[model samples]
Target: MTRQQAIVADLLHACAHPAVAGAALFALSADAIERARVGAARRRQSIGAFVAHSVADFARVASERDKALLARRMRGAPAPIVAGLEAILENPPRA
Candidate 1:
């Protein structure tokens, strides 16, 4: 597998962590992972660090209940974006 794919797989495997073992495995393309790698490399970060930060970012966005942003994103957005938006709508974050 490519390095990008390996990063994603490692993130999936890391889901077994006790605190987040219940978290669902989100799918991402190798291309997306590669983009993240490029970004990480630019910042002199490791691939693993980049992937972990990305997953955390996704979780943060999914937890945010910003309706205006969610509504704007719903128009012709990708599946992952839509899922994040729905997650926000269904479960607004506690203050």
Candidate 2:
């Protein structure tokens, strides 16, 4: 696999691990923290919930973009490969 694909595969594997599944921790810049805090307050959600939702939304969009890229790259592939990729694009796994 290409470097980007390898990195994505590693991240997917890490996320699937029992200890890390559904939970993650990472540091953010002070500015970003303050912004998220304010946004959360506005939405009547806790900062953690807001950040989780935001991250989920971002992942969903990124997944769509990746699918689109895959579709473009599959333009001249064999029929079976194209069909398989089409199925995957149509039925992406739930986050």
Candidate 3:
């Protein structure tokens, strides 16, 4: 798999094991690091917490956008299928 795909797969695997405690190392530009530091300070949170919250927020937003896009695409589908998809979206199955 590609590097980005591999990273995403690794992250998903890590998430499946919440009991595992570990640190992730990322390479960022100096400016990016400084920006994160400033943002963390503003929120009175540590850099790690700030970054974790940022990632979680981003994932939530992206998931919403993806669901909206899928709903739009499903509009032309048969009525029953669209209804079923909507129901599933409204109440997704637990992992």
Candidate 4:
């Protein structure tokens, strides 16, 4: 198995409940898993590709959300989560 697939599998297997495992796997695979759900293995992409695309999409969302400069200037008391999110926006995740 590829490193990406292994990591995904490990994450799935670590789930304590059967339903949670299925839910996590379904979320990770998303479209690819749906293709397989209809008995179309040939139409499904690799789990690793799905994971990469999902991560890239989420990163884009994070970048866009952080792009609003006004977010850094919110008035009144700031929520702890917002403060932490602001810190993350100021300093991006390491590649």
Candidate 4, poorest ten consecutive residues by summed lDDT: 80-89
lDDT string for model 2 (1-95, tens) is 65445434444344334234223323343555565567669889766565555444434555746645544544445542323223332444456
lDDT tens readout by residue for model 4, 2-91? 443343333323332334423444433244345324322343644334333333332444453443322332223233223322333234
User: Can you write out model 1's per-residue Cα lDDT over 1-95, one digit (the tens) per residue?
Assistant: 74433433343345324233222223434455455457568868655555445445544553323433443444444553424323332343334
Candidate 3 lDDT by residue in tens digits, 1-95: 74433443343344223122113313333554565577669989765565455444433454645445434544445542223223332333333
Ranking by TM-score: 3, 2, 1, 4
Deviating ranges (above 4 Å) for candidate 2:
1-26, 63-95
Decide which is better by TM-score, 3 or 4.
Answer: 3
lDDT of 3 at 87: 31
In model 2, where is the ten-residue run with the lowest total lDDT? 80-89
Q: TM-score for each prediction?
A: 0.35, 0.43, 0.44, 0.23
As a whole number from 0 to 100, the lDDT of residue 42 in candidate 3 is 91
Look at candidate 1 and give me any clashing residue pairs. Answer: none
RMSD of each: 12.1, 11.8, 13.6, 13.8
User: What local distance difference test score does each model get?
Assistant: 0.43, 0.46, 0.42, 0.35
79 in model 4: Cα distance from truth in Å? Answer: 26
Off by over 4 Å in 1: 1-30, 64-95
Between candidates 1 and 2, the lDDT winner: 2
Q: Which has the greatest lDDT?
A: 2
